[model samples]
Target: MRQFSENTFESLVADTQFIRWAKGEQVADSQKWEEWKKNHSDKTREFDEACKAVRMFSFATPAISDLEVDYLKQKAFDRSKKQRNTLGTVVWMRRLTRVAAVLFIPLLLFTTWTLLDKKQLETTYSSLVENRMDEEISVVAPIGTRTIVDLPDGSKVWLNAGSQLTYPPIFANNGRTVHLEGEAFFEVSKDETPFNVENFGPTIKVYGTEFNVNAYEEEEVVTVALVEGSVSLAKSGGELFLEPGEVSFFDKSSETIHVERKNLEHFLCWREGKFIFRDASLNSILRVLQRQYNVEFELSNPQLGSYPYNATFQNESLEQIFQLLELSAPIQFDYTKGYLNKDGAYVKGKVRIK
Candidate 1:
C-alpha cells in the first residue's frame, strides 16, 4: 500500500511484491501494483530506479530460484536498515556472493550457448510473418524492442521495432537469403554468394558491406541506405545500384526506384538507439517517435505536420521527448496513457500536438 517516493527505495527494495515485479515475476498483488503505478506517474523516475536496483541482483552465471532471491533480498533490507551508511555496502557484497553461488550455473550455460549459437533462434515468429520450411528460423522485434539476428552464414542483422526477419537456420549451402517485414540494419559478412534481402518493395543484393533497409508494412516503399560497399536493387524499370552514402527508394506500387545522395548517419542512427533528424519534417519526426516508443500522435493542426525541425534524441523517455519537441517547434503537446478497449486490448499512449 506504500506508494514509491523519495524515501521509498529502501522499503520498496525490501517489499517482496516490488522485488517480484522488478524481476518480472508475476505476484498475486501485480494488478494492484499496476494500478498503483498508473496512478503515481510522477514517481516513475523513483520507481524505475528501484526496479533497476532489484533487477541488478539478477544472477548471471547461476540459477537461483525466485523464492531464494526474495529471501536474500529481505535479509539485505534488514541489514541495510540497521547500518544505513557503512553496513549497507557490505551487505550488498555479501548478498551478491550468496546469490551468485546459485545463479552462476545458469549463467555459465547461457554463456556457453551464446558463444556457440549467439542468441537462440525463435520458432514462434513464423506465424507472425509467413509459412516457412522446417529449417527456417524467424525473429520478431515487437514495438519498442530491437532484435539482433545471427544468420547462418555469419551475417548479422539488427531488426528495428515491429520488424520480423526470416532465414534458414543455415543458408542454402551458404547461398545467403533472408526475408524482412519491417526495417533492419545489415552487416553482411564478405562472401562470394550475394546476400539477398527480400522485402515487399524490392530485392536488395550485396556481396559484402553495411547498409540499412526499411520496408515497413504501412510505408509504400522500401528504403535502402548504403553505408559501405555497393548494393543492387531489382526494380521494374531496371536494376538500380547504390554506392556508399546513397539512398534508394523502391516504390512497391510502381516497382520503380529513386536514387538520391543522402547522409548515411540519418539512416544508421536508429541502430545505435539514437534518433537524428536533419532538416526533417514534423511528420517524419512523429513517425520515428511513435515507432520507437510504441505511442500514437495527432497533430492539432495539420499544418504543424509540415514544420521542419532538427534534433537528436537518445535515451530520452517519451515525456522528455515531448518537452524537447515543444521547445524546438511552435508546438505544445498533451499526452494520455490510453486505457484498455472493450476487447481487453490496451491502446497505445497518445500525444496531441498543437
Candidate 2:
C-alpha cells in the first residue's frame, strides 16, 4: 500500500499505510527502517516529523451525548435555519448575538456545521483508519523455534527459527504481500493478485508458487530457492527469474545475483527439522548451526572458515552436533554454557572452534 511518494506533510499524512508505519504498527518497513532512513536520507526528516505527528494525534470525542439532547439541538438548528431564511439581516444579526454564547460552546463547530447542513464530518474517516490499523499483523519465530503461519489469502508459511513475518490487514481484500526476514518456506495460494515477499532490499514475486527465501540479517547474501512454481527476485538495479528447482544468491555488496540449479533438498531440509549439508563450506555450516542451535561460534583458525564438509543432523544436542563436526573436519570446539544476563534471560551459548 504505497500511497504516497512525496515527502510533504500533506502527502505523508495521506499515505494509505502512513499511520501504521509512523506509529510503529506496520512491520514491513519498520523492521529495517533505520537502514531505510540511511538510504533515503533526504526524506528521513520529513518521515520523522510525520511519525511524531501521528504519535501525538488521537481522536477521543468528549463523552457527553444523549439522544434526547441531540434531538432537541437538531430542532433548534432547524428552527434557526427557517427563521434565518425568512428574517431580515437586522433580525438575524440580533438572534445571532443572543445565541452567540450557546453557539461558542463547541468552539466554532456550531457555526461550521450550521452552514454545512448540521453534519459531523469526522466519523467516517476515523472509522476507516481505525479498521486498517487494527488489521495489520506481525508474527515472530523466536530463536530455536519455528512457526507455521496461515495468512489471510490462505497462503501457508513455515517461518524458520529466529525469523519474522508481517502482513498488512488489507492483505485479503487487496494485494497479497508479506515482509520477511531471516528465512521462510512459502506455499502461496493462487490468486489473480501476485504474492510479493519483501526482504531487506530485494523483493520476491510469485503467483501460486512454493519457494524458500533466506535473507538473514547477518548472512552475506539473499538466497531464493524455488521449490515449485516460478519466481522473480528484484533488487535495486536488476531482476532475475527462477524456475522450479532453481536457486539464486544475491550479493549485497556487489548487488549481483548468481543462479544455480542445485538439489532443493539442502535448501529446504530445515522445514523437516533436519540439517542436511552436502559439501557445504565449514563457515556456511557453522552459520546454519548457530541459528539452529542458538549458539555463537568463533573460529580460532579463520582459514578453516572455507573448509568443505558434509553432514546431516536431526534431534541432536548441540554437543552431539559439535562431535559430528569434529569427526568431519580437523576441528575441535570448546563449549561455554549459556548464562542468564542481567535481564534474567539465558542467551547465546558460546563456542570456540580451532
Candidate 3:
C-alpha cells in the first residue's frame, strides 16, 4: 500500500488490488485505500489520474441501444443496493466499470460463437481438399481368376474373371464412383451419397444394395441383376428402376432397355465359383467357359452354336466340363497343344467342338 503511493501511473493501473478497488469489488481494500489517501494528501492528484485512466481504458464491445444501456444500468443499481446500504465513494468512482461489465457479456458470447463457426467451416473445406487430392487406383481380375476387393467406403466387390475396376484411393465428398469392365457383384454400404458404377454404356446407381452387373464389351447387351435392395440403371436417353430379384437388360445396338423379374441367383452364382445355365444357347455357354478358363474355342459346325443346353458345374476342371458337355449334347471336342514361340514360351491351347 505504501509502495502504491509513490508508484508511476502505469504501475498503479496494472496493480491487481488497485483494479479490484477501481471496479468496486474489494470493499475492504477500498477502505484501506481511502485511509492511505488521507495520510498522503500530496499524492492525491496522481491517485485520481490513475483511477481515471483505468476507467477510460476499458475494453471495447458492440454498440448497445440507449434503452438497453439504461436497462442494464438500472439492474446494476438495484443489485448494488441490495448488497450495501449507502452508495459510497467506491461506487461513485466505478460507476462506468459496472456498465462496461454488462456490455462485455454479450460481446464475449458473440466472439465464442464466431470462432466455433469458423473452425467448422475450415474443417469441412479441408475434408473436400483431401478427397480431391486422392490418387486414382485400379484392380484387375485376370482371365481364369477372381478377386475380392474392399473399397475405402466400406463396400465389398467380387470381381469375376476378365474384369477390371478403377476408383479413387479415397472417395469424394459428394459420392463414390467406380469404372467396371467385364462383370462384378457389389455389396454396397449404406450412405447419404449414392454409389455409382460406370460400365461400357450404362451406369448403375444405388444407395445400399446387393447387385450384379455384366457389361462385357464384346457382348451385345449389358445385364444388371438386383439380388437384394434397389438399383437405378441409366442409359443414353432413359433410366430403368429395379427391385429385388429383378433384372435389367440394355441393348447396345437398339439403345433400348428392358426390365424383367428373374431368378437373381443365376446371375450371381459365378461369384461363388458356380456355373449355372438354364436352357442357354451353346454359343453363350462356350463364351462363358472361354472367359473362365482363359481358353479359345473353335466350333467345327456353326449350326451347333444355337443348340440349347442346361447344366450346373461347380469347381469343375476344363476336361471334366468338356466331357459333361459331350455327354449332354451331340458334340465332340478335340484338344490341341500349342507350340512354343520364338521366345521359347508355350502359348495357350485350344479346344475345337465338332
In terms of lDDT, which candidate is strongest? 3
For candidate 1, the 10 contiguous residues with the lowest summed lDDT are: 120-129
How close is every model to the real structure, measured as TM-score?
A: 0.58, 0.60, 0.61
Instruction: Spell out the clash pairs found in candidate 3.
Output: none
Model 2: worst 10 consecutive residues (lDDT sum):
117-126
Report each candidate's C-alpha RMSD, comma-separated, in the order given: 38.6, 40.2, 18.9
Question: Model 2 TM-score?
Answer: 0.60
Model 1 agreement with the true structure over 1-354: per-residue lDDT tens digits: 545576766777778888888898878877876786788788767778898888888977687899999999999998877788667778898999989977998999988987666433344344333454455788999888898988867888999988999887655445688999999999999888878898987788885589999999877678999999988987554667888989998787887778899878888888879988888788878877777889899888999988998889998988898899888877898999868999999899989887
Error of 2 at 55 (Å): 99
1 or 2, which is superior by lDDT? 1
- Candidate 1 wrongly placed segments (more than 4 Å): 1-135, 338-345
lDDT of 3 by residue, 6-41 (tens): 466677677878877766664665787788668868
lDDT value, residue 246 of candidate 1: 91
lDDT of 2 at 200: 70
Winner on lDDT (2 vs 3): 3
Error of 3 at 111 (Å): 27
> Which is better, 2 or 3, measured by TM-score?
3
